[model samples]
Every structure is written in C-alpha cells, then in structure tokens.
Target: MSTVLEILHIARFGLAGVFLLGGGFFVLAGAIGVLRLPDFYTRLHAAGVTDTMGSTLILLGLMLIAGFTLLSVKLALVGLFLFLTSPTATHAVANAAHKAKLKPLLGTYRQTRKGDNEGGSQ
Candidate 1:
C-alpha cells in the first residue's frame, strides 16, 4: 500500500512537470512568433492561440500539483476564463484593425541579384 501510494505521488508530479514544460515551450514559441511574424494580424494570431493554450497547460499543471483542493478549483476557473477571453479579445482586436483598414502582406517576394537577369533582354 505504501509503495503504491508513493508511485502515484511520483506519477502525479511527473505529469505536472510535463504539463509545465509544454506550457513553457508554447509560451516561448508565442513570444518568438510575436517578434518574428511579419504583420499585426499574424502576430496577434500567434499571441492569442499560444496564450490560451499555454495558460491552460500551466494552470492544469498547477491544478495537478494542487490535487483536490480549492486552489485547483480556482486554477480551473482561471483557465476557463482565459480560454474564453483570449480568443475573443484577439478577434475583437483583429476586427478593429480590419475596420481601420489595416492590410496584411500578400503575395511572394523574391530578391534577385543585380546580375541575375540574364534571361531577359539587356
């Protein structure tokens, strides 16, 4: 009985650690996307999607660690709130930007070398 309970404890912690690590990865990737993406809409999408997912994973980890407690309940509620709000906020901002005439970059761009136009007439 003792060994079984001990294993359960270790498993819970291991699962929590995995959730936390995954959350951290998503958050980091979101930050990178916000920095590296070309346009406002794309950046907003990256931030919005990752924010909800990352926060949910982190809160789930916290809930796992909290285990059948009020803290876990609170974390769940917070997660729900963020899950509902983040995308709504993102959409609202995107809509506003669109209404204000913010345009996204479209089409392909290729940089040609100065001497690379050999196929055409000089």
Candidate 2:
C-alpha cells in the first residue's frame, strides 16, 4: 500500500513537471511570435493563444502540487477565468483594430516599423 502511494506521488510530480515545461514552451513561442509575426492581428493571436494555454497549464500543475487545499481551488478558479477571458479579450482587440482600419500585412506592407499605429488609410 505504501509503495502504491509512493508511485502515485511520483506520477503526479512527473505530470506536473511536464505541464510546467509545456507551459514554458508556449510562453517562449508567444515571445517569438510577437517578434516574428508580420502584423498586429497575427501577433495578438499568438499572444492570446499562448497566454490562455500557458496559464491554464501552469495553474493545473500548481493545483496538482497544491493537492486538495483552498489554494488549489483558488488556482483552479483563476485558470478558469483566464481560459474564459483571454480569447474574448483578443477578439475584442481584433475587432477594435478592424473597425479602426488596421491593415493586414501582405505583399507591399510586409513590414511596418514598431510603434507605428497610423491605422492604414481611410
């Protein structure tokens, strides 16, 4: 019985480690996407996706490590909130950008300078 409990503990720790690593990778990808994507919309998408997923994974790992405490429940709630909000926020931003006439990067507009928010032409 003790051995079984030990194995379960080890399995939980290993799973948590994997979740953390995956979350870290998502964060790194988001950073790279911000640096490399052609335009604002794409970059926002990358950020939104990464933020939601990375936070969810991280919170899940933390919850696992936290066991059945109040802190664990709080972390789970936070994760749920993050999952709900990130994409909605992203979409709102994208819609605003569209209404504001921000143009996508294609062909001639391949690369715009950072901090340029002219919103293309009317």
Predicted structure with the largest TM-score when compared to the true one: 1
Q: Write the per-residue lDDT of candidate 1 for residues 2-107, one digit (tens) a residue.
A: 9999999999999999999999889988989999876676789789647677898888898999999899888888888888888888889889888877766554
Per-residue accuracy of model 2 over 1-122 as CA lDDT, tens digit each: 99999999999999999998889888888889988876787799789657777887888888888999999989988887877888788889889988887787554443455434543534
Give Cα-based local distance difference scores for all models.
Answer: 0.80, 0.80
What are the runs in model 2 whose C-alpha is more than 4 Å off?
107-122
Q: Which ten residues in a row have the lowest lDDT in candidate 1?
A: 113-122
lDDT of 1 at 109: 19
In model 1, what are the clashing residue pairs, if there are any? none
